[model samples]
Target: MKQKKKMTSTGFLLLITIVLFFVMYAAGMVIFADKGFAKPQMFLNLFVSNAGLLVIACGLTIVMITGGIDISVGSVTALVCMVMADLMENKGASAYVAVLAALGIGLLFGIVQGYLVTYMGIQPFIVTLAGMFFGRGLTAIISTDMIAIKNKLFLKWANYRFYMPFGSTNKKGKFIPAYIPPTVVIALIVVLLCAILLKYRKFGRKLYAIGGNKQSALMMGLDVKKTMFKAYVLNGFLAGLGGFLFCLNSCAGFVEQAKGLEMDAISSAVIGGTLLSGGVGTPIGTMFGVLIKGTISSLITAQGSLSSWWVRIVLSALLCFFIVIQSVLASAKKKK
Candidate 1:
């Protein structure tokens, strides 16, 4: 009965998020029809622009589902970008080598932070806060200035686009093919893999159990600590991959790159219906959250007069709203 209730609540939250996204997007299409908000390319641009955030949000969802938070992901992304930029631009490293280095850096942080949180029993926020500082400090140490990536391979990856069979026509009546970069493909794959892991894998079940109640999970003979450690490690890896994708989009790196991005990831997961208290989230829902974010940004840009900061403002409002909803549902469950 409890399981059914959990499933029902999860579905309810996800449905709300999906409906909200469509409603907001429809409004944009109607209000900005002259501005091409209805264009297919405009819709595709959301994914193209936010692929990195999508991947990072998936990682955040995983950690949050385990009742943990990592505020260091934004710092990690900055560090990864700076390191990759320094490697390929200055040290003459191949893009492939730089990519491997990014993954290694992420793994190193994951191992260290995960060990601290799981084995040492340190609070996750404290440990990741220190991590956040360390990562940003290390990024500045690499170079405070922006390093633009001029590597051929890296540029090739950034420039490459896959065109769709269908698209909108231009003023000249020429069909402009809608396209996406490899980053979108990677983000979508991450979402699919994470959804599968949480839904079908034993490890995922253990995570859910631990998040629901640590003592109960222990009673069930689940390796709670190890599972949490693995969760952080996986999150770190995704942070690295997401940072790389972000770099592909920008083709540059600086100390301030991806600043405050951690909040964006957290908000995306939350707005997607991932409970801050843990044990409830879906990657598919998170994807829609990201799309919602993208839609808001696009809408603001289309409006032309509104400041971009409105995106943050609206997201903050939405975040608070969902958190309240989650609390209410949780309270009602307790009463039942």
Candidate 2:
């Protein structure tokens, strides 16, 4: 056999990073430079603002890589947080215990969806679309209002910030200034682990293979169903994890949290060059994609000149454009 072509991933990642950096840089200059973005807490908001998006995008990337989509992830996230709040308040469960229970619920959904798609020969789109509805309704059943989390452990974790020693000088010739949150640290760790898995592991490789061509992968004896099943489970788990973090950050949970977030995750994946039809993508690209999308919102919000809804308009156009480009590229590669 010809030496298996190892996917050269960094080029795509670098491109996304460069594009995202410029977007952020431009936004910062236009919106934040007046005070050098020098608000005491503004620096820290950079990480906090995009933390949940990063986590959501990371999970979504894995599912996409397997040629499957988890449109329900956003809803699952909302439901997971609802579970946490209900368990803590109604059942008097500890926050830690509630979190695990939430994760379990996510895993349960994963199993159901995975089974339907893999064993029943159901289409991913159909299975996950139904899952999306199920998760949404479940979230509504739990609560339609914002459920405030007052658990002691949850509050303590939410309030903690991991600060770096550095800053601006004060008028008195003393230093004044910044901090980072534990959320950023947690987000980074999750992103890093995902990158490593997507880039290095055997399962990761198998994910690409199954996504690239299910028939060919099966001919080579790869357990296609099993792989996709694992990917979905992981996606659900991450959704749950992300939901928990989002709750920790916002200190509340509601049915509508992360609304339309599946699109956000998919858009990030595509911009980062993860093929829509499947088989190619990276966590790094998804990360940059999240940053870029986040920057757009920041740009619009900071200007105070337009409704943030414009962000969606731009994202929709970009998504269409990228999908077309991807289709053309996949065809060309096939002919070659």
Candidate 3:
């Protein structure tokens, strides 16, 4: 009974977020009926639009659960995109080479940051802040101007769509097909893999133990340093993957690409019930968090009257609300 109660409490915020999404979606259905917000395509659009964000948020969730954070993810993602763009567009590199280079850069960034944080005893925020500057600086050095990706292979992949069996019909009786983007499919696969890593792996259990209490974890013979280091490295790889997905969506890259994207990832993770204090989170919840943000943006777009900034405002409010709830839950757990 105690274990069950603990699990329920841990998941409280996730449940609240799920409820909030449904309520908002139901409201959108009523308010934007004519705009087809009620259509199935709108529902799938959430995944298609925020697929990259979903992957990043899942990465962030892993870090947060281990009592670490990476503020440089946005910059790193932009750098990855810029590197891939520079390689393929300017240097005539093959698509395979560009993709591999982007992933390698991401992994390298993670390894360095992880080393500093785990071995050198640097604060995560300070280390990641430096990382942010380095990544953004490198991106600018590569090219300040936007580079449109004209790589035939990349274009083919980006344009490819997997049509859903069901779709809505327009007033002209033409079938408006619903489709999932490759990026969205990639995000889903990442989420599933993360779910398995967190739930069933030995490293995952150690991560939670360390987050719960570092001293206790050490006392129990856990290799706290190595586990935490590995966590950040994994985060970097996922951030790189997310950058690739973002590039797919845009089919272009620039120094400014994904500016402030780290915040979005962090917000999604928090809203998904990943505790800032660490030791708890789920990738599935993070996916819903991304979906919620996408839904808000969709609702705003469907209305066609509100400024895009409203999405930020609403998300900020939601983020704050979830944070407060987390604080209260943490306090209660302590009292217990």
Best candidate according to lDDT: 1
Could you give the C-alpha RMSD of every candidate to the true structure, in order shown?
Answer: 2.1, 3.8, 2.0
Query: What TM-score does candidate 2 reach?
Result: 0.89
Which residue runs does candidate 3 get wrong by more than 4 Å?
1-7
Query: Lowest summed-lDDT stretch of 10 residues in model 2?
Result: 1-10
- Cα lDDT tens digits, model 1, 191-277, are 999999999999988888888898999999998999999999999999999999999998999998988889888989999989998
Error of 1 at 173 (Å): 0.6
Task: Note the Cα lDDT for every prediction shown.
Answer: 0.92, 0.78, 0.89
Name the candidate that leads on TM-score: 1
* lDDT (tens digit, per residue) of candidate 3 on 1-336: 232364666677888889988999999999889988888988998988788889989988999998999999999989998999999999999999989988898899889999999999999999999999999999999999999999999999898999999999989999988999899899999999999999999998998988888899999999999999999999999889998998898888898888888888888999988888888899988888898899889988988889988988888998898899888777776676
After aligning candidate 1 to the native by TM-score, how far in Å is the CA of 311 from where it should be? 1.2
Listed in order, each prediction's TM-score against the native is: 0.97, 0.89, 0.96
lDDT, residue 45, candidate 1: 93
